[model samples]
Structures are given as C-alpha cells and as structure tokens.
Target: MNPGLLLPSALFSLLALLLPLLIHLARRQQQQPLDFAALRWLGSKPKPRSRFRLDDIPLLLVRLLLLALLALWLAKPVLHGAPDRRTYVAVMPGVAATTVAMQALPANARKHWLAVGFPSLDSDPPADAQPIASLLRQLDAELPSEAPLVVLATTQFDGADARLPILSRSVDWRIVAGAPPSTPMVTALAAPRLQIRSDSAHRTQAGYLHAASRAWQTPAEFTASSAAFPNNQQIVLVWFVSDPLPTTLLEWVAHGGTVILDSSHALPQSRHPVSLWQNAAGIDLLQAIAYGKGRLLRFTRPLQPAQMAELLNAEFPQHLHDALQAPGVAPIPADARTYRPQTGANAYPQAPYSLQPWLALVLALVFLSERWLATGRRGEQA
Candidate 1:
C-alpha cells in the first residue's frame, strides 16, 4: 500500500540472496593441505561428489525470484482508487415530536429527509414520546444509499441505539443534539409562577410582569417589561398551552425568527381550530423549529444557562448567530463560528487493516521454499 516501505523490503530480498553468496565465498577462503594417512580410506570408499553445485543456476534463479516476490508482497502494495467527494445537506428535527412525526410522514418523505440530514433524534425529550430505536427502523426504509447527514435536536439523548443514523453501505451521519438542562442555573433563573389572567390582551403584552413586580417593585417591573426585547439578541418565543399563539408569530418565523411552541399546548383542541401555521414541515413546531439558512432555532422548554451555552456551542450555531445579527430580529451577539466542520474533509470514519492473514501466507511461502531446497539436497546425497 505504501511505496515508502518498499525500499526496506527490497533490501531484505537482496540480503536473502547475499546470505548464500557469503557462505560460498567464506568456504572458498579456507585452504587445507592433503594428508597421505587418509589416502587408503579415501580410495576404499567411493569418492562422494560435492553436494552443492553452481550448475543449478535455474533453481537458484527460481528461489531468488520467489524470495523477491515474497518480500514485495510483504511491502504491502495497494492500488489507490478514485477519491470520493460529495456534498450533503442535513435537516435535523428536534426530539420526541420529530421522532413520532417522522413515522407519520410519507415513506418517500422520510427517505428524502434522512438522505440529507441526520437520522437519529435525541434519546429523550421534555415531553413524553416514542424511543429513537423504534423510529430508526421505521425510517431506515427511506435513507439514501450514500451521503452525509446532519442531526439537529432540542435535547441530547442517551440510549442503546445512540449512533447517528447512516447506512453501512453508503452514508455518514453526524449527530448534533441540543443542550441539556443545567440544575444550578435553572434554580437561579427560575421564573416565579404567575396567576393566569383571563384578560387575553394584557397577558399578551405583559404575561410575567405582575409576578416579577411582586418580587422586585414597580420600577423593576416596568424595566423588565420594557427590556423584554433585548438589544442585539435574536428574540425566541416559547408559547405554552394557556395562551394561543398569534398569527403574527408566523411572520416572525417566516422572516427567520426563532419561535418555539409546546405541542401539548399548541396542538388544536375541540374548542378551537388548530392553526395550520403551527405544523410547519409536519413536525408540530409546538414541538420545535430550527431554520437552517436563517440560523434560528425554537424550542418549548426553558433551558438553564449552561444548557443554553451548550446549545449555542454544539447545536445550530450558524442559524443562531444569523438570527441574532439581523436588526430586524434581536440585538444579542451570537458566536456563529462554533462547531464548524474541518476544511476539505468529510465526516466519515477511516477503515482499519487486519494483517494476520497476510502474515500467515508469508509463513506458508517460507515453509514451502525451505522444503523444496531440502528435497534438492537429499536427492544430491542419494
């Protein structure tokens, strides 16, 4: 496989040839005087011809050729094939809702979706849902023969089947799950529960203001309400069950704003007609929505500060930064460059070599060669 190692093998082959030559030369260098005392015994016994003969040139050539071939094989010759280069686009849906919704989509849709993006979702979600393994088998039927898939999720998952979904035959899938919960930060920033005001318009304008005011004061309450739209940060809306999300949210999402709604709350009930805007891409956005090009993501659960940091660092950093940078959106500064792939590289594992069989073949060849040389020596003695 590697030509650089062949030089040493060639030298080894030469050494094999030189061993016999050196032995022959050393024999010739020694000289002995003839003794008359041995003449009677030498005459009585039939003189034995030399066991080694220079006339066996063809056999010597064959042995040397075999040694050279064996050495060359040991050097590990390999033929390089064409380089594989292909670009792929991935669409990762968030956990549970994504896992179940994938089953509901058309078989062709599942195949097309997995072919581009990561296949597996996080193991767990904030809400109750089916396991990832079950989802994988259902979606496996639609995956592409070969490509790279990217995974996006609202939460990280851990389970027996944790590998990102990709076909052993062709595709390579990389998983990118959302940040997990942080206990300390969640405890510190925990929002106080507020009484649900039946006044819909007031709730829309300042739902958490009254509760925040009770803990702090009137000025603090006014400041918090005014500061709801932070400068330089992308605004992410998390809608729950009690308050119906307005259609204006769609305009925000369409413009690349991050809006997360809980499926438990956002899904339609018998009392109200479920809005079609909520089910973008058939994945209940009430579940989660991550806009790839816009660099924006929306999730239902309020994450801890550490979890939030992990999301920015590991998940969709590009979309996150893009959403933050647009003045039309928010003023928060985002680190967009995190978790980028290496330049000119694909996300695939390299193959490993197992050399036991090759070593066995070499040993067999050495044994056969030694046997042939021994047989020739025995024939000469006979």
Candidate 2:
C-alpha cells in the first residue's frame, strides 16, 4: 500500500530538530590542564584542527530520532490502495434479522444495516426513511473494489430515486420477507368541486374552466363569483385574474388548496417551478409551483382555441384535471427478480485509513526509549 500525508505542510515542524542538536553541542566536556605533566608536553605541536562534534552521541541520536517521529506524527500520514476482500451483507432497515439469518450468507461475511455509517445489525434498525438506490451507490463506492456485497431489502421500500443507479459491482440484491416501509399515500376526493373566482376582464377565460368542470360527467359543484374567494380547502380554485393574488388568497393556497391561475396572472415567488403539462410538440402548456402543502398551476397561454390549439384538443380536459391533481405516494413493490445492479460503472477511490494512532503509539515508544537512555547516563554519572 502507498503511504501519503494528509497535512504535508506540517512537516515544517522538522525545523525544530536543530534545537536538540544545539543543546548537545553547547554542553562542552570540561577540560583541565595538568601544570606539572611532562614539562608542558615538552614542545607544543601545532594544535590539531578542532573537529565539530556533540557530546553524548547515543543520547543525541535518540533525541534527534524522537523529534523526527514527532514531526511525522504532525503530518498525519495515511495508507491507501490496501483493498479489503471480505464479503459484506447490508440489510435494509425494514427486514427482520431472523429472515436474514435464514439466508445462506458467505462464510465469515460481515453483517451491517444499510443505513448511514453501515451500523452493525445488532443495533436497533434505523427508523428514518432510507433512500434505497442512493444507499446502494454509496456502499458500492466505499467498499473495496474487490469486496463482495449482498443487499437484503423488503418487497416495498420508500424514498426511491427517479432512476435506477448504475453501480461499480454486480451487487447481490436479495429480497427478504418483512413489513413494507410506511409512507403516506395521497388520496383524491370522491367528487372534485371547482370554485372559480374571476374578474370582469377575464370572464371569458373562466368560461373555459367551467366547461371543463362539467365535462367530468359527474356531479361536480361548480361556482363562479366575481369577487369572493372560496373558503373551503376541498374546492379546487380556478382563479382568472391578471393582477397579483391578495395575501388572503395566497394563504388559502398554502393551506392545501390547489389553484389554477389565468395565463396573464402575475406569478407568485417560487424558487422552483415545474412544467406540469406539455403539448405534443413538447411546448409547455402549464407550469406549477409548490406552496406549502398545496400547488399553484398557471396556464402558459390564454385559454382560447385560436392562441392555444390544445383548448380544442380532446385531451385538454384530462390534461387540466391531471395538472390540478396533487401528487400521491405509490408504494410499488420493487422487482428484486429483475432489479439486479448493472456493472461497468465508474468506481470511486476508497477513503484512506488514518495512520495517526499507529504513529502515535510508535512515537510514545520512542519517547520512552529516549528518556530511559538520558536518565541512565545521569545515573552512571552519579
């Protein structure tokens, strides 16, 4: 495995090594000249050129080694490219542990819940909704490229993404029998009612919505007023006014009342507006933006056969009905039989393990050895 440093800039601490070297050099050995020794050594030869050296060579070396290791620890080294080949089984949150136990798992395979952190299965199952496809992609990228993965999920799962995710490995997607994920489903009213609030200017436009309401062929309560807005949340409001909506109307829409606005009406403030309906030529017909629990839909063009040909189209009423309908949660069973993961997708580099703890242990050992040597020399002197 290749070793790398996380904080390479911290290596500047190595400059502190000069401190130990200076200390050993400054503590010169005491020298005493013997006055009566051999007549001052007869004739003094040229003083031998002084050679630079530090006292307590062994102690000095150990001190230098200690400082070097300390500097390395500060750099925060890591090891990469070391692949773990163990087999892993990730059980989705809703599945029972007993069901997983019945399945024939690989020998010595590690079992973990497929939630955040891949917590061990021994802990309580996560309660929060799990995004199945997203978690699978995350797990696939984190595990070693050569590691084998087995996923245990129930028939129905909540929080499914829009599309199937392509993964790096052919993950063993296994379906275990268990209770399905709990998700709130949207239920439509038995007979939808229309409440039209139009201005004198847009009376012609309100006629279009009135005609569509009658086209439902059921007893749909249709009411039109020039000024008063409906107070009932169950009624779908078709508002035909070019001016900005009043605060009361905006608040009503926010409280779960769906509104269809005129083409020339000033749009409300929204960060994300979705195109809810489009014509055969892919031209957007209606744009909708979410407001609290409700939705506000606006026609892209004036409700006239001359300007928008869709007004005369047979499918226009159905399209209008669909736009006004709120979205619902459908807990469709995941087809584990054919929902196998596709291979050949790009693989992500595994996160490197930090070498700090191991380095710290070694640093401690070296520190103890240095202290032992320094204290031993003092004991000999005493």
Candidate 3:
C-alpha cells in the first residue's frame, strides 16, 4: 500500500482503458468496401469477423477490468486496522535467580522462558548466558519488533556502572535479583538452599579445593586457554573431586553438552544447605553457575525423583518439555503422570506469512488462462 506505487497503477489502468477505445476507433476508420468476384463461393467460405466488433467490447472490458484490479492488488492494497497485529514478549529467565523464582511462579502465568546458553549452528542452540543486551538483540531479530520484552536476571542491580542498552528500548523489562521486592510487576523468591553432604572430612575438604581450582580458572584462565582446545570441544571443568574429567567430557560440553550438577555433597560444614558461598580466596561461589556455555546446577540437598523433576522443570523447562512432548529426543512421552506435571506454553513462536499465498494463487490463474487461450486457437486452426 505505497502511495507512489498506487499512482503508477492508476495511470496504467487509465492507459489500458484508452488502448481498446483507440483500437476500436482506428478499426472503424479503416473499414473499406470491396466487390466480390464469386458471390456464392464467398458466402460459402468462412468470413473473418471484425476483431473490434461491438459484441467483443464487453469481453474486452472484462479483461481490462481484471488487469486493473490485479495492478491495484499488486500495489499491495490492505485494509487498515485488520487486527492481524501480532505481539510477543521475550521472557528471559535470569541465570540463577530467575530459575528459582520461576519455580515459585503459578503454573498459569502464560509466559515463555528462553533458556540461556551458547549459540550453535548444527542443532537448536541453547540461549546465551550473557547480559540482557546481547539476548535482547538476538530476540529482536528472532521475534516481532512490536512484541514486549521482559528480562529477568539473577544478579541484582546495585546501580552499577555497566550500562545495558536493552534497558532503554520501548519494551517492558523487569530485573529480579536478591530478595523479591514489593513491586506488583516483579516478584522475588528465596534462593533455593543448597546442602552438600559429606560423610568423610576428606571429601568435604576436597570439594573446597575443587571450588578453588574453578575460581582460579576464571577471568584469565578461561580466556587464555581458548586456543588450546577445539571450538566445539573446549574443556570448561577445571577439576572433579573424584578424578580429572577426561578431555572428552570438555569436548562433549563444547559440542553442546549440558553439565548438570547434583552437588548435594558440595555444601560446607553447616547441616542446613547454603545457597551462597565465598571460597577461601573470597571468590563468590553460588549454588548454580554457567561457565563456557555449559550450565552447572549444584543441588545442596539430595533430590528425590520428584525433586529432580522440579529442578529440571525450573532449570531447563523447554528442553524437558521438548524431550517429553516430542518422542524423538528420547522415547519419552509427555504424559503428566510420568513426571511431576509442569505445564507451560512452548517458548518459541512460529513464523507468519501474510500476503504471499494470495499473490501466488493469482499468478497461477493468469498463466492458466493464457495457456487455455493458446490451446483453443490451435484447435480452431486444425
């Protein structure tokens, strides 16, 4: 519906009308009388009728009107306020905080949570774990511009110096971190308590050492060692208490492996599980963290089958749903009875096609008519 295109179309339609009129008038002026040598023979022979006869005017008008209507359509005529408007909200669940808060949310909240991870090409990639700005740009490209967006991060904004552009966009974004505020728009939930069970002093002490190794590997170790490993098989885990995890484990994660930790035995001396901890080096170690595009979820308490289901539901709801809803992921049914039922809408939306189909159909009809007319003329000649 561009006005510039419409103007040319209207001009073309007027030209089309004038063309037939001009032909008709020229034919009338060119008409001449001729004497027949054999009157009887001439009468018997098939006479070629006037191509511009008045009877043919109606059919010509039909053809001309069809062309004009089609041109107008090609100009992309559309009705205003047709309610075909589609809006979407990109719901980004924060790394640790959002995971726990989402668990406490009522199941009826019609929102989609995009799981954060690294981007991949071969398969459906997990969401990125970076700041909301990067995620917002990705979602902007993927979702409709008119859609609202809400970003839920696990980290509380202490009015930091790091500015995120996503905050300024004309979208509804709410950040939930630390304790929940009284704001109606945002809800905060208690961080899930994590308890590490250790029967022996050695295991308990080793866990802390492993935690130290992980902390040292960060900031510099993570970035410096990137070139040493394959892009798809980067080793992210510094150490596992039992043994140094094979390079294969790192490769697996780099190649899209999801490392789920049930660190029920990783908690400190306290009997009650601790959700937050600072290592001996004063580096903050939380109950859950994502490193090198892989997710690490440490559960302080031993998970029952039901608890595991709940944890999985909160952490990777889309993956869990896909595994259940689709038989292909595993031979698992999305039956509610099989698992603790956690129901929600699929996070991804389908692409939309508006006028492409109608245009294709109209083109097909025009070609078919031309073919039919050509065939009819050939049959008459035979």
Candidate 4:
C-alpha cells in the first residue's frame, strides 16, 4: 500500500522551519569585558574557549517544534493500507435494489456490498457517472489484482460508449436490462453572436462549426476574413493557414476578444510559450494562452468535418463553448457539466489515516507552553 498526502506538494512549507532558527540566532547576547586591572592581569593568558552554550533552550525548542507541527499539519499526511482480500458483490448504475437483495457473501470473503468506491452501502450514495469504462479501469488499478470482482450493472451502461479503456483485472460482470442513468440538464445560454473565418481549403471544417452552432439553436455568420472587428462583443473562431498568425487574429485576441485556434491546421512558431492544460498520459490535449486581458485556446484534436462525421464525440461543442465563456458573460456553472467529478476531489479516495488533527493538537499544546513560559513570569510581577 502506498502512503499519500492530501496536499503532497504543500509539504514544501517545512522549509519555514528555518524561520524560528534564524530568530533564535538573531537574539544573540553580547557581554562586555570589564576593564578591571587585577582581573585583566589574571585572565591575560588566553581564556579557555567556551563551547557553544544556548540560552532559553526551552523557548527555542518550543518555537521550533510549533513550526514543525504546523508544517506537518498542512501537509495532510495519510497512510494507505493494503486492501482486504474480500469477495465483494458490487451493484453498479441502474441496478435494481430488489435484484441484489438476496445476494450473500461467501464465508471466506470479508463482505459483499456496492462498488461505489466505499466499503459499505450506508456511506454517501455513489454518483451515477458516465464513461463507466474509465471508472472500472480505476477500480481495477486500486484493488488487489487477485481479488475476484463480481459486478452487476445494466446492459445500457455496458454499451454507453465505445471507447472502453482496458482494465487491469478481469471482471465477472452480469448485465441486466434496465433504464440508463439520467443525464443532468445543462442550461447553456444561447451563445452570443459568433463570427466564423476559414481558408478556402478548410471550408468543410467551417461548415461543421456552423452546423454545431445551429444544433444548439444559435446561428453564426460566416465571413471571408476577420479583418473587421465587430462593434458588438462577438467572438471570432478561426482556422487560418499556419505560416504567419494573421494581423486581424492577433489584434482580436490582444483586445480582449477570445479566439479558439483549431489545431487541425498547423500553426506557425509562436514566440510566447503556452503551458498545456488537461494533459493525459503525457499528451497535452488542450492549451490556454492569456493574451493581454483576453485569452487564446488551442485544442490538440482535429475538429474537421470528415472527423466529425466518422467519429464525433460531445467534446467539440463543449470545448468551443468553454473557450468562448469569457469573464462577466453569463458564466456557465462548472458543476453543470455532466461528466465532471461529483466531489471535485481526487479521482481515487485518499488513505484512511490522517495526521492533520494530531499535528494540530501538538501545535496547540506547544503554543500554550511557549506562552506560559514567556508571559506567565511577566504577569506575576505585574
């Protein structure tokens, strides 16, 4: 089992341990040698070198310990335990409670329950998520490879998507006929007036873009060139020839207008470096670039008409709409996206053990002791 930290990178805060050390060193005491004639003559022979002796040892230790505890607490350390080799029966999305009511666990196995990333059924209800192949793959990786998994879900879920990710472990699945999970209704606004520009060579791609807009009940006006900026704040989505970024496009992005750069066409070398967003398996699928107050987004996948016809997924329109969503517009709430995480936490649950509360208690105790040592004496005198 691998140990994990909730905020692993935040452990760098431990470097602040030096702050207390520096304060203690700065509180140096300087003693002046008295000009006593008799004492001077007696100590004229080089006095025995004094070894390093520290004053206020308790106070210095308390301060250092306090800082150390705070850093540990902030790190949110967790210890992962090995999975209990259990023969668990998991009910998946759309599985009827009546169907799984009579299932019993074998005596050798620890338990049988729902496969909602939890040990029991009484915990939080699992989200009826899509791309179930991805979820199954993750479960495969997390659980022990040897443990047998019996999954009961619906046939509709099994055939939900063709892009099923391969799982590490073999699963014994029983598919039943049942209704599919309900997709949440996303109330996307009728898009603002959009201007489309494309080269003659990429006309088909531009046509598909226009079609997608119309599918959402918003029609776009096509233009031969995007040289003329719209008086109204309308977005310009472009698929231009690569060698040199056109003057019109650059100006549009610079002046706080959003531009979605279609990656199907090769782009010329750009001087400004942009970091890739939403990278998976070392492949960066999306990149967002900030240009002045505006932004530029580049999708690494092609959105050509041929590709759309052959293998169109829901990604194109969703991606396009997100790039167009600028500041102060009727912003789409992030949770409204159907495929996003339920808790917006890590994909895998963290290990059970946490050091945060324990560390906090230690910090509190050290602080109280330090306060007592520093101010208790002063208060008594007063």
lDDT of 3 at 359: 58
Worst 10 residues of 1 by lDDT: 182-191
- Model 3 misplaced regions, further than 4 Å: 1-14, 20-34, 38-62, 78-89, 93-110, 115-132, 138-148, 156-163, 166-172, 175-357
lDDT of 4 at 291: 44
Give me the displacement of residue 180 in model 1, in angstroms.
18
lDDT of 1 by residue, 161-200 (tens): 2122333333223444333221110011122222222233
Let me know the TM-score candidate 3 reaches against the reference structure: 0.35
- Give the best candidate by lDDT: 2
User: What would the TM-scores of all predictions be?
Assistant: 0.28, 0.49, 0.35, 0.42
Q: Candidate 1 regions off by >4 Å?
A: 1-13, 24-55, 66-79, 84-363
The candidate scoring highest on TM-score is 2
Per candidate, the number of residue pairs that clash is 15, 0, 7, 0
Relative to the true structure, how large is the alpha-carbon lDDT of every model?
Answer: 0.35, 0.73, 0.37, 0.54
What lDDT tens digits, residue by residue, belong to model 3 across residues 1-382?
Answer: 2123423454455556666567656866686767777764655666676566554455456556556556665665432222222433334333343353464343333344443342322234233322333444446556544444444433332111112233323544444443311111111112111122223323443354234333434221222212333243222232223333334443333233333244433421211222333334544333532222233334433333343333333333333222212211111111111212122323344243345357557766765664565466558659
- Screening candidate 4 with a backbone cut-off below 3 angstroms (N, C-alpha, C), the clashing residue pairs are none
Model 2 lDDT tens row, 1-382: 9999999999999999999877765655344546776687588668564444443787888889989999998999998866878898999888998898899988789999887678899999988545566578778888888899998877766544323558988888888887754543434545567877777788877777777888876434445544566666667787776666665565555445577887887454422467778888998888876553356778888888898988877777787777666463233444555556678889887778899999899989988989998898889879
If both were scored by lDDT, which would come out higher, candidate 2 or candidate 4? 2
Q: Please write out the lDDT profile of model 4 over residues 1-382, one tens digit for every residue.
A: 5667888677688788788777656655354566876666664576676433444676777877887778777778777777666765665555666665555546665333343354454444345434344445556656665577666666543212112234555566666544545433222224655667777766766676687677656788787664576644355555444445564455445444665566754332322324443423555554554442244556566655453332265565554555345332211111111221122223343246776777778888899998987685457548
Estimate the lDDT of model 1: 0.35
Model 2 CA deviation exceeding 4 Å by range: 1-23, 26-59, 74-76, 80-82, 184-339, 357-382
